[model samples]
Target: MIADSGLVDGLRPSPNFGERRGHSRPEMLIMHYTGMADGESALRWMCMERSQVSSHYLIQEDGGVVQLVCEADRAWHAGAGDWRGRDDINSRSIGIEIVNPGHEHGYRAYPPAQVASVLALGLDIVGRHAIPPENVLGHSDVAPGRKQDPGELFPWADLAAAGLGHFVRPERLSGGRFFGRGDSGEPVAAFQSMLAAYGYGIDPTGDFDERTRAVTIAFQQHFRPCKVDGIADMSTITTLYRLLGALASSPLAAQGGSRGAIRTA
Candidate 1:
């Protein structure tokens, strides 16, 4: 198969992909970590038909990019997840597996070369597809509780600085009124609503349950990496608020509807 991006340094086609359903092109970009010992191992696993998993691209530690699945096909990455009330993420998103051992093994910081490669490839994909900034997300953001690849240590702020994903300066952490699992009230419901509005798959149940905690952790991992305890602390709340506020001027908002609007009061 032909590589979709000129940035690809190599191609190792995988048979674990199929036609994208319901959508003709990707609407979102999902980032992931291989969670293996090295890039070669990860690449081999993805190419193995028995693995049943593959991503559009994989970037090695030294910045080499390998295209495994064609962008026109749905890669078997993002399993069982929803974003913006929509399921079947594999059909609507392009996945990029960054090489890292992940939390299970080492979970070290990504190298500079690899990060630069990610930034370049991300910009290229988003630019060509016109994907909105808010649509660029981590695996945890879509499949919270079940996965956390490209974990908190991943350079999300760096990616934002390079004009890839949506991000804001996280509020300073401090002692304040916070909500956790077991809390149930209007406040909890309001917080859940805000998360849902920002494209996270959450229900405004008014009860801070396990699902709520998982989603909160996911948000903190991507936005407020300084702390990620699954508690809706003031820092987390403010960070989320600012992110939603910035959405007013985002391209998704200019699509002629109130797609990202949420009550900030």
Candidate 2:
């Protein structure tokens, strides 16, 4: 099969894909890690039709890039997830799987070579499709409660530095008031609102439920990587505020871009 991106070094088509629904083009880029002992195992699983999971591209630790599914087709990567209240993520996004022994096995820092390849390939996809910075997200970001493939160790800030994703410098960790699970108040509700507004799958409920903690952990994994304890510490809340502020002032926000679904296969 022909590769959708020139950056692809090999074509290893996976049968676990289908025609996109609701849209013909992808509007988001979902990143994930293999979460297996090795890249080849991950590739084989994704290629098997029974596995029923595939990503458009997979980058190995040595920087090799394999194109498993054509960009125009919808890969069965994101299972059940929502973003900004939109539940059809697979229909509107391209998925990339990075090679790594994820949390369960033995999560580690991504090798420099792999990261370089990811940056190049990701930039190519983002530039060609014009994917919004905010739309470039980790699997955890889209499926907070059930998924966390590309975990806190993933270098989101590096991607932001390369102009591939949205990010803001996290506030310094210090002593101050914070919120956590079981907390119920208008402040918690407002915090939830900000998370929802930023496209996280969350309801603005006044009570900080377990779902809120999961969402908070996801947010911290992506933004405040220095710490991700599922508790909304002073640093986490301040970092969220700063990130929201940054997004509000971004050019995309000014144009009133919809956070729902994007189409750019």
Candidate 3:
């Protein structure tokens, strides 16, 4: 177990992790919610021999922190998820599980204290690890189809304000124009391309398939929390464009603006 940061107040080791493949070091921070009734139950499950699941750390609702797995090891949090072009998310990321009931048993908004703690701890982790702001993502962002824990009510805006994750003010949703499940053609393809360019695991296909809908809802959940009905409205699309612009305007792509914005539409 590597002790890079000692922000975790408690240390409860779990036996569900192994060495990260290919001597991989973490470059991202993936946050999750326990999705159980309480932290103790989630901790117990993660520690059990049969569970075969664990995260590097679990933060309680009362601002308490605990470390279960090690930073150098691959925890069992991000199963079957992709980011950018990488499929082995666990191998390249550190996972932190927060305590929440999740969508299964009535997901609720995280307490203010819990959010504050997450912000602080997340800042500490990302800073120490030198992770890019965009690299700090939610579990739902990585596995949108299979997961929704740490749902839209998780206060991503607060985290962004604290410089833990990447976010932009969402354009308010209006009933002007929108696209949904049955929508298709160049517009859909353009949308997909934008999403893919922003590191979402979506193919730039012109057809608005189920996968595209899932990814849209996931984007809304994190970026535009006003609504998450799997429909990409003007607000969602504009927010995506603005976010892309924000990324382009960053120092990383300031050298040449020719390739930053691709108008697939």
Candidate 4:
């Protein structure tokens, strides 16, 4: 298979892809971590037809890059997930798998060389596709309940410095009124609405449920990295509010939160 980008060093094609149903082209870039002991093993797993999972690209721990699926095809990376009311994430997104052990294994910091390569590749993809800053998202952002690959340790701030995705300095954590699961009121509904408006899939039901908590954790993983407790504390809320404001004034937000579609990283 041909590499979609010049940055790709080689190809190891995977058979776990199909036509991107309904979508004409990818408008979003989703980031994921291999969550395996080694990049080679992870690449092999995605190539196995039985694994039934594939990503357009994979960046190895040592900074090597591999193309697993062509960007023109829909890779079976994102499973059941929703963002900004759009449910067919695999159809509208280009997936890039980063090599990491993930939380379940021996989660650790990303090597600088690997991060630099990923940032370069990500910038190329977003620039080529005109993917909005908000459309560049982590897998956890799209599949909050079922997945958390490319977790908080990912260097999102560096990507933002390179002008890849939406980001803001997290508000300082402090004692304040916070919301969490089991809470119920207008404030809860309002919080849920804000999250939805920012591309998370949640309903303004006036009650904080398990789904809301999951989404909160996802939001924290992306924005409020200092804390990922799933509690809507003052810092989390303030950060979310500022991010929304930033998006409101951005040239891309006019196009859509996730560019043409609406959703995650």
Candidate 5:
């Protein structure tokens, strides 16, 4: 098959993709690690119809780019996930699978070559699609409860440095009034509000339930990478506050939170 994107170094089309639903314009970009020890194995699985999984592109560990599905088609990479109340993520976003073992089979830090390749691909995709900074996210951000590929060692800061995604140096962690799973009250509600406001599929329920913990873990995974104990600590809150502030001051918020006020992070 011909490569969909000229930037792609090669092509290995998968039959697991279909027409995109609802809006044809993609507004998000979801990233993931192959979660397999070998790049060849990951490629084989993605190409198999029975796997029912594919992405627009997959960058091998040695900086090789392979197109598994066309960008216009809805690749079945994001299954049973949500973002800003939209459950059909695969229909509205581009998915890029990076080569890594992930958290299951001896999760390890991504090598420099792989990261650089992904960074370039991300820049190209965002430029072509005009995807907003906030919409670029990891698979764990969408399916926190089920996935954690592209773990903390993925080097989000490097991506940010190259002007690929939204990120800030997390505030230092320190002892303070923290919130955990059992905590329930206005504070918890406020935290939930922030998370929802930041596009996570959660509501301000005033109770730190299981869903809340999951969202918190997701938040830490994306924002405050220093810790992911499922607890809202001082660093987490401060980092979130800074992120919201940046958004508020960005050109995207020209209408002054018309989408939704920056109530929380």
Candidate 6:
């Protein structure tokens, strides 16, 4: 495949891509960590047809970038998931697989050079596509219950500072009313509504079920990395509220997709 970005250091075409559906161009960027022993193994896996998985780009631990699929095609990276009430994420997003022994092997911090490459490539992709800041998200954000790659250790704040994704200073943790699985009420429904409004695939069912917990954990991993216990604490709630509030002025607002105001009480 032809390289989509000039920043690509190499090319390793994979046969696991197809034409994009429902959308002509990508509107989101999804980040992931190769959950394997090493970068080579991860690369080979993506190139293997049997694996049934491929991303548009892969950033090695040493910062080398390999383009597996052209930006115009739909790579088989994002599995079953939805964002902003839309499905077929693979058709609407560009996927970047950052090399790291993820939570399975030996979860660790991303190195400096690798992170720099990610930042540069991310900036390029988002700029070219005009992807909104809030639309750049981690795999966990799209498929909360089934996956959590590019986990909590990923430097989301750093990327946000570098003008990639949307982020805010997380609220400080403190004593307050919190909700978890099995809890159901208007507050829980409100929280679910906020999550749904922010693009997560959840419903305002008024029940903090397994899906709610998983989505909460995903939100915390991406936004409130200080804690990710799947319980909606004051910190998580306030952080989400502020993040939604910030979206009013983001590029997404111009697209008529801005989230409605949510009450955090």
Please provide TM-scores, in order, for all candidate models, with all chains considered together: 0.94, 0.93, 0.92, 0.93, 0.92, 0.94
Candidates sorted by lDDT, descending order?
A: 1, 6, 4, 2, 3, 5
The sequence of per-residue lDDT tens digits that candidate 6 reaches over residues 1-265 is 5778899999999999999997999999999999999889988999999999999999998899999999999999999999988899999999999999888898999999999999999999999999999999999999998999899999999999989899999999998788899998778887887788788999889899999999999999999988889998878888887787788453334323312322333
What tens digits encode model 5's per-residue C-alpha lDDT throughout 80-146? 8898788899999999999888787888888898888888889989998999888899998888778
Which portions of model 6 show Cα errors greater than 4 Å?
249-265
TM-score of 5: 0.92
Clashes of 4: 4
What lDDT does each candidate get? 0.90, 0.86, 0.83, 0.87, 0.82, 0.90
Model 6 worst lDDT run, 10 consecutive residues? 254-263
TM-score winner between 3 and 4, please give it.
4
Candidate 4 on 1-265: residue-level lDDT in tens?
8887899888999999999999888888999999999998999999999999999999998999999888989999998888778888999999999999999999998999899889999999998888989989999999987898798999898889888899988899998678888998767776777788889988889789999999999999989888899998878877887788788454334324321121111
Under the 3 Å rule for N, CA and C atoms, how many clashes does model 2 have? 5
Error of 4 at 185 (Å): 0.1
Error of 1 at 170 (Å): 0.2
Lowest lDDT 10-residue stretch of candidate 2: 256-265
Candidate 5 lDDT at 9 equals 86
- Once fitted onto the true fold, the runs of candidate 4 whose alpha carbons sit more than 4 angstroms away are 248-265
Best by lDDT: 1
- Model 3 has an lDDT value of 0.83
List model 3 lDDT by residue over 1-265, tens digit each: 5555667788889999988987457888998989888999999999997998999999999989889898888989889889887888888899999999888877988988888888888888888778888888888888878887678898988888878788999998787556789878777777777787777899977788899999998899899998889987888988887787777344324323322232233
Model 2: lDDT of residue 41:
98
Better of 3 and 4 by lDDT: 4
